[model samples]
Structure formats: C-alpha cells, structure tokens
Target: MGAQEDAGFSTRQVHVGASTATASPRATPIYLTAGFTFSDLDESAAHFATGSGFGYSRTGNPTVHAVEERIASLEGGDQAILVSSGQAAVTVALLGLAGAGDHLVVSEHIYEGTRGLLLDNLARLGIETTFVDTSDLDAWRDAITPRTKALFAETLSNARNDVLDVAAVSAIGAERGIPLVVDSTFTTPYLLRPLEHGAAVVVHSASKFLAGQGAVLGGVIIDDGRFDAAASGHLFPHLAHSDRLGGPSYAEKYGRRARGQYLRESVAPRFGPSPSPLNAFLIGQGVETLSLRMERQSANALAVARWLEARPEVERVDYVGLPSHPHHALGRRYLTRGSGSVFTVTLRGGLDAARHVVQSVRLITHMTHLGDVRSLILHPQSTSHSGRTVAERELAGVFPGTVRLSIGIEDVDDLVADLDQALDSVASVATGGRRTDAGTRGSEREVVVL
Candidate 1:
C-alpha cells in the first residue's frame, strides 16, 4: 500500500476498491446498513471534524465508495461521486457548478430527458442555457458569457451518433475559464476516456452500459481534478470563502479535491440523490466485464450498420462506424478503440415502417434503454423525442422514420436475421403482401406477451 500500481485496465477493474471481507469472499461485500457506528464519543467527534469516514448512508457508505473508486480508477480521475440515475448525475454535476442566474452552453443533440431537465426543470431554478451545435467550435465560443459556468455535451450524442470533438471544445472552455462537462453515457470509459482528451468531468448513466444487464439504475460523476479551481474559486464562494467561524475555505483545505468534495459533501446529499448500496454493488459487478461486453457490442453494431446501409428499406444509417456518416472521421479520431454501439437508422417508409420494424423484432427488445446484454430498439420520434418541437426533433436526427438501435452482445447473424424479417415485414405490408404465422412466434420470456 506504500506505492501506486500501474495495472492494466482489465486487471484494475476487477481488483480495484476491493473491500476486506469478513470471511474472505472474492466479491466486494455490500455494506447495506443505513448508518455506521463509532466505538466512542471521540471517534464520532473525530469523524465529524475530519470528514474522513462514514456515518450516515445518505452522505457516504463503504459499498458506494468502493464502486466510486473503481469508476474513478477506470476513468483516470481523482475521484467520483455516485448518484441515483443518469439524470441525477447530470443534475448534480451542473448544479455543483452553476446556480441561480448562472448560464450553461450545452449541445443541442443530447438525450431528450437531459434536454428537458435543463430547459425546463433547471429553468425553474433561475439557471439559463444556450444550446449550440456540438461540432461547431465557433458556436461553442460565441455562446460563452461571463456567467457561463460550464460547456456541457455528450462525447457521442444520444440517439444519433454525432461525435463531439472533445479536445477542440475543451480548449474553448479553457480559454473562457469554464469546465467542460461531458456525458459519457453513450461512450463509456471502455470506448473513450473524456478526461484524457481534455474534459474536466465525465458523467454516465450507469444503469445502461455500466450495469450491462438492465437490472439496476445508477449514475456517476468522475472528476479529473485538472480544472483551474483556483481561478474559478472567486465565482464559487462556497469553496473560496471561509466558514462563519473563519475556518479555511474548502479550496485552501482540499485544493484540487474541492470540486468533487463540493458535490459529495453539499450538492448530492442535500438534493437526496444518494444511490442504494445494492445498486452500487450491481454496477461494480457490471464494470468487471465492461471491456468484454463493449468489444462484442461494438463489433455487432458495425456489422448491423453495414447491413442496414445496404437495404432498400433504409433511408440513412447514423452510426459512426459507417463511412457515410458525417462524423466518421471525427469518430475515428476520438473513438479509435470502437465507435459506440448505440445509433439510429432512418427507414424510407417513415412512421408506419418504423412501427412495423419495432413491433416485429423478435430478438431485440422493444424498450427505451440502451447498453444492455440484449439488443434493444425504439421509435424515437414517437417515444423518446415525442415532447420536442418539430425543429428540435429534426436537429436531433429524429425523423418519423428514424429508429434508434442499441446493439448488444447477441450473435450478430441472429440480430441481422431479426432486422431482416422485420424490414421484410415492412416491405410486405407496403405492397399488400401477407405472410402466414405472423403472430405465433414464441419466446422464452413470454410470461405475458399479449
């Protein structure tokens, strides 16, 4: 324990944040208690004064801290804070930076849930936002004002596969003394590390790819500790100014650790976004196989995108792995390992065709989530993007025909076969064609398939 070990990712992921089990179990034990006990009055007083240990589960817990350390180690960050959901992670991360009257320059092509959170929920709190095209660095620069606290974006846009040039965008934020907060939900650390490229903070919807099995809900915020906290301390009086009793400011006490501490000690706990210890355990189990699942999923996605691009029923394939995609080159530059597996396919037949394909996919699940062991599909315009205006939907690549696909680790050929039959169903219905046994196919998961 005297020296840090530079272990490879696969090794580190499985071994990091290992708790000392009472009976030597190989897996991390879940410390599911709502609160911890101290041996004596001095011990409790010491804990409160130093903030070095756990007391209440709402503020901290050993189980959750283990998972946070693992994610931070994987993300190459100083520390991480776990929250209840991806939306909670984004909310806490932004609220830690901006408050009433503060501004944020955000990407237009983000998850509709996140968009609504910013434009609607946060607006009620007096925070303002200016959405700009993520790829256009000039617009990113033009949107920054004196009160702008952060440049928020996703590494690979949600639903669509538009790649954000992180290095270029971070440079602009650096010039304006603002941190770049990236939602890496689409491209987890296995596919990309936003901090190494230039982002100051990275966030994820751990419920999706991190859990990898769709069994739990969790989120994380990883801080690289490289943002200029000293310069921005003036803007954040909580970290810059002294307490009422005239103690040193958080910046003076924690320095580079202050931003993450603010989120941990103040924002997240006050907002009550604490994750369950059981969910943290599930996310940790999922992280152990993250690299393996991501590799298989990315390869499967590329194969499916190619297949879709060659089909007459397809209008456009919005996967970055395809050469035809506008961001293919930028995707290559950033996502050299693999372009993420979540993408969209626009059908030539519009809404009806979308409905047919979504309903007919026997293998892929019809759900709203991405990043699972099983492939999933959704019709965006009528589902995730339904609340957006026509212009807003168009900006996010959500046409009546656009369908989002999250490729999984299923056999690529089987996935293709499912899509082929579904697309064929669309063509058949269009030409007044009928096929026998259309409604009788069976699945093992048919507990109630009506």
Candidate 2:
C-alpha cells in the first residue's frame, strides 16, 4: 500500500490499473464522464502542463489506463497506449516514428487494412513503403534506404500464417539503428511477445484475440522503452530534438519511454483515436482469460488444419502448426506456444467451391472478422484482399479458392464435422451430387463440385 509494486501477468491483468482503489470496487470502474473535474485552476494547470492527471478522456481514462497497463505488463513493454482500433494503432505508431517523405520497409504479407494504410493513405501524405517477403532476409536488407525510418511486419501474418522471424529482422534493424515494429495481433502476448525478441515496438489489434469475444474494438502500442536517441539520433532526429513550442524534446523528457510518451501525449490525442471506457473495460475483461482461450483455440485450429490437409478436395492449408508449411520451422523457432487459431485453406475447385464452402457451413459463421469465440470463415479473395492486384493477392496467398478460417474454442470434432459438411456440399456441386469416396478415405466422405 505504501509503494507501487509489480505483479504477474494474470494478476496484473486483473488488478494493476485498478489498483488505485478509489471506491474499493473489485472490478475496474468505468469513468464514463468525458472530463475529470479538478479541485481548482492550479490543479488544472499542473495536469495540463505535466500531463499527470486524466483531464480529458481523449488523452486518457482510468479504465483505458488499466487495459494499457495490463497489456504492457503481459507484453513485457515499458508502456502502452490504447486506441480506438487496430487501424488507429498502426497509424499512430507509424506516424509517431515517421513523417512525410520517410520510408518504411514492411513485410509483403500483412493485414489488408495495414497494406491500404501504407500504400494508400500514408502514401498520399508522401510517406513511401517498400514491401519485402516475410522470409527473405536479403530482400529486407535491400529494401532499406536512407529515408527508411522503421521495419514493420506481422508476428504471425494474416490468413496465410506466415510466422515472422522477429529476432532476425530486429537484428537487422538494430544493425542499422532502425526500429523494428511488429503487429502481434495474431500471436497475442499469450502466444508470443515480440518485444522480448528484440522488436523495438509492438502493436496489436485488440479486437482480435485480445478482445476474445469480438464485443469490442481496441488497439495498443507498446514500446520496449529502450530507444536511445543518442544511439539512433540521426535516424530518429524528430524524437531527439524539440518539436513542441518550448518544451524539451520527448527523448530528453521521457528518456527510454520517449516514443511511447510521444504517442500517448501527441499522436494518439491529436489524431483522436480514443477508445471508449466501456470498450476498454470489456477488452480488459477478455484479457483475463486470454491464455485459456488461446490454448483451446490453437488446439482446435491445429486439428482443423490436419483434417483439411487430409481432405481430397483441399488444395493446401496455410497453418504454421502444420509440418508441411514452409514456415513451420521458423514458427517453431519463434512461436513456442500454439501457432494461433487463424489460417487459410485453399480448395481445389476454385472460386465456386470456395463460395459453396462459405455458404454451406452451418456452425461456422461466414464473416470477415477473425479471432471470435465463435468459428468464422470467409473467402478472402473476394473480400479482404479484393482490392489488391492479382499478383499482390497471389503473393499474399489469397487465391481464388482460399477461404480464411478463424478457429474458436468449440469442440474440435464439432468444428471438423461442420467443415466436413461444407466440403461435402462443395463436392456435391462439383460432382453433380454424386457422392464419391474422395474426401472419405477413412471417416470423412468424398466432396466434389460439378
């Protein structure tokens, strides 16, 4: 009670931010008011001047702070900033490090929204980005230039399940004094901690596995809290020098937490991606059972991947947990826990078969989102990656028959049975409703499309 203390992940998740103990309510109370009242003008001036108190919800909130603290503790990061959504997280995190004319080296395969952000919106603002294959170290090295401010990638890529070599890429960035930023939404802290693997910064789409229930949307940016301006001053001069009116540079004021502080005070507030206190509370509640949910989901996903691999109508399965995956070794190296619940499976019969599978699934919801408690399936070629060029889609593994699956914590057998029925529907369409023994080598029946 006398001094602040550290705690374990689960403990911190439940109690860290709410530890201030205002009303002695066990659950983190949601401060729904837009602004906090100050005792007098002097207190208000101090709050604004030093950014100590939560004067406004846009800048900070107690509920949101608890979520941020919990995430930072689990992620092994110095500090965390909560935003409205994953898109906002990426936008603020990148802009906090880069500006107009700055360049970013990014993995070719990432969430489509992120691709759009870099190539469409940020591009319009004069920021340039170069995409490199996730596994190509040489390509990553070649893509960097004088203007390159950061290296960005997903810890576990969307749909295709390509596991990023965080340590390898972070080493490359460290050599060049560039910060390596990774989107770790797929592999939440329960599965992986990018910051521990040398990544300078970590971002997450809390709407996914972090929220666990798909009831709220939030995002977080966690810095390793060790970026030194003196070491990387030339590359990140913006953080090292005075950019504010007459205030000291962020690095001078916050030291190792300069980037995080800048994002908290300047970027997130000014950009206005403030998350609702209620959403923060919901997400925080989800964080409580994150590890348990992830364990079950990962197991169910691996089972589904195995079942799909054996199906005759299936062309390929893109899951890092599978031994056949190109990145299985890398995944094993980096992802010690299960390889996440989201992956893609390509059917042999092309777009028609994909549509049939999406339409026929009874238990699996046909939705664009991922990481829900309920199983979800989607045809990414026609949805998430539709705007991308054919070549781009191919590179990202969004084939005509590719259907992305986000496995849930439901019974593995039930999930597989649902897929089997969907596959049978596809087979019936492919084979004129004539049942074949194709997919039914053992227990699964043959599915065909006419």
Candidate 3:
C-alpha cells in the first residue's frame, strides 16, 4: 500500500511518488526515451485528441511526472509543473498569468535574476512590474492597478533574509481577487508552505533545496487550485474564451483545475521549458532526504550567523534565526522549523573586506549557487546584482561590502571555524591586519559548537 494521507513530511518525501511499475522498483525509474511508442493509429490519435497519455518527453515523462506529484504533495498544492530551470518556472508562471499590457506587483527583495526578468525581459514583452518594500502592506495595495494580475514575492527573501508575511500579502491579493504567486525557494516546503497561508501558487528552484546535493538543475510551479481564472474575465479573458471547436471554456472544462490545466496544457508545452527526465530523477533522489538536510543546514546556519555577529569586520548578519535580525519575529511566526539558511553579511570594512573574506574562504566554495550539501558564497554586487544601479542594488539589500552565504548541512563547529578564519583575514587599513575591535569578539560568538 502507498503512504497514508496523514503520513509525516519525511515519510511522504521518501514514498509519495515512488514508481508503480510492475517490476516493483524501490526507486523512481527514469524513463529516458525521447518518445513513447503508440500501440496503434487510433491510440495515437486518442492520445493527442484528449491529451490522455504520454506522447513525448517534452510534454510528459513518467519520471518528471512522479517528481511533480511528490512536490505538489509536499507543498499542499493540487498540481505541479516541473520545468528546465528556476527562471523558466518563473517565466512560465508569469507568462501564463500576464501578457502584453499586463502588470505585476512584486517584492523589492527578490533574486536579482528575477528583478532583471521583470524590469528587462518582461518589459520588452510589454508587461510591467511595480516593486514594493515587502514589509509595507500599503505599498503592495497602492501598486495594484487594473492591469495587475498577480502579487509575487519570496516567502523568505533572497540574500536579505527578511521573512515575508504571506498571510498579509495574500490577503491583499484576495481582497482584490488577484492571485498571489510565492517563490518558496528559500524556505522549501520542509520549512514553510506558502499555500497554507493563502498563496494561490508556489514556485521553487528545485536546483536548490529540492535537489539538495547540487548535482542537478530544475524548477517547479505548484498550484493551490483556488485561483479562478474564469472568474476575472477582465484579466484572464483567454480562459473565458471558447476554443476553435466551440467547446466549453477551460474553466468549464477543468472546473477548479482551470489555472493548473491551463499552465500544463497551454503554457508549459508551447513555451518548451520541460525538464529532462534524468534531471527529474536526480531531483527526486535529492528530495528523498530534503527534511533531514534542511534540518541540519538550518541549525548550522544559525551557528554561523551567531559567529558572524561578533566579528569586528561584520556590520550586520541578516539571518532571521538570530534575534538581532530585523525579521526575527516574522521568522519566528512563520518559519517555526528554523529561520532559513541563505542570508547575507555586511562588512564594516566595506568592499575591500568583502573581497578579502570571499577570496580567503577555503571550506566554503565561492559559487553563484545555493542550498548545496557543501557551503557556498557569493559577492552579490559583483555577480548576481552587478547589472543593477547603485540605488537598485541598495533597494534589494545588495551592497558592495555584502556577501551572501548559502549554508549547508556541515558540522556547526567546522563551519564556524571556517567563517572565523575568513572574517579574521579581512585586513583593516589602520591595523594592516585583521581588524581587532576590543569588545566585538565577545564570548566566542555565543553559538553552540555542534
């Protein structure tokens, strides 16, 4: 028998989407072929006509479908679509909801790549975005106009570590009948579920936490099945429009599943952002131990944050796990498991100090990626946020002296030692070596040496 409905998250991650092949394989078997064979002409016609069976890998693969189901189950969503990359998933989700002349109200504290997607790529497409300070609910409300289709934000924002008030934002969208799309990449379903707080869709960079080992790249869009595209004809007129065959509209055809089916049937396929079956298999394998990895990674991150706080070279530690962080209370309310691991550190010594610490880290690999089994670091101003202006960068909490850390499931003591060495390596112009503040290194950072 399959897992029970009330099974734990850890149990579900390991078992919810296991293969049902007659051979009874314990793992999800990767269906690596480009296409599936049809038994007869009628079968092929029926498959295309009704969209019932697997036709090609681009549209559907058993391996990809299995992982999709697993993620949907974990996120408390009705359905999910796995895509080529995180950008592709965000593109598909946004494109499905908006088109030419449409607009989106987004959180200012988002990934830089996405900031470019809205301000650059989507702008060319004639769609616009209004960015608001995520903590200001009034800004979110005032930004919405007649063209606004969705309110988008990260559950726990990238780099800055400010926790989103999902309930507050989603309530604003709810009042306006606009669906809320949340990027839960920073806080995976293991730590938070956006749907539970009234978000209509949850997006993830499966390459991060979902594929914990960093061996594969993938993304997923999970729908709560609550947003009725047909209800708002002014915005989603396409859903209400009839087909060439004069058939019932998508809302009439799929009932509550209209939004999900539209993305799966209309948007995802036409855009061609499908995930490779091999990648899907790898993501599924990584997901099996997601809860375990997240638990350890979160714990390790808190220790590192505490350690960073006491450094003379540090200006501030943005990890919400720490009480000193601005969003600690918000994180406490929402991220009950642990405050997220991916956060930024601002150096008092400025850009020179950032360069020194980043170059000196031996254990923490200097990379652009996050949520790996091994710790990683990045200078956002030079890498991810380099395209933006000084003002834009500062708005998103990207500063010249700041470096983002994606904490991994490593020994807390070892991670602390590595940071201590790296931060201590940052030389002050006055001292000509590690900046030694008299009171800064108090009580060895107060973190438990796990």
Of 2 and 3, the candidate ranking higher by lDDT: 2
How far residue 160's Cα lies from its native spot in candidate 3, in Å, is 1.5
Better of 1 and 2 by lDDT: 2
Q: Write the per-residue lDDT of candidate 2 for residues 1-450, one digit (tens) a residue.
A: 222355566765665564454468799889886998888999999998999888999998999999999999999999999999999999999999898889999998898899999989999999999999999999999999989999999987776788898989999988878999999999999899999899999999899899989888899899899988877878776788887577688888889888889888889999999999999999999999999999999999999999999998898899999999999998988878798999999887776678788888999998878889999998887788877766677778777777899999999999999999888767557633323332211221123221
Which 10 consecutive residues of model 3 have the lowest summed lDDT? 441-450
Model 2 stretches with alpha carbons more than 4 Å out: 1-22, 430-450
Model 1 agreement with the true structure over 1-450: per-residue lDDT tens digits: 112268777777776765454586689889888898888998899888887688889999988999999999999999999999999999999999999999999999898889999989999999999999988889999999998989999988866789999999998988867889999998899999999988989999999999999999999999887645567776677777886689987787788888888888889999999899999999999999999999999999999999999998887889999999999999998888898889999887766577788888999999989999999998787778878766667778877667889999999999999999899867665522222222211121112111
By lDDT, highest first, what's the ranking?
A: 2, 1, 3
lDDT measured at residue 6 in model 1 versus the true structure, 0 to 100:
80
In angstroms, the error of model 2 at 310 is 0.6
Clash count (model 1, backbone only): 0
TM-scores of the models, in the given order?
0.90, 0.90, 0.89
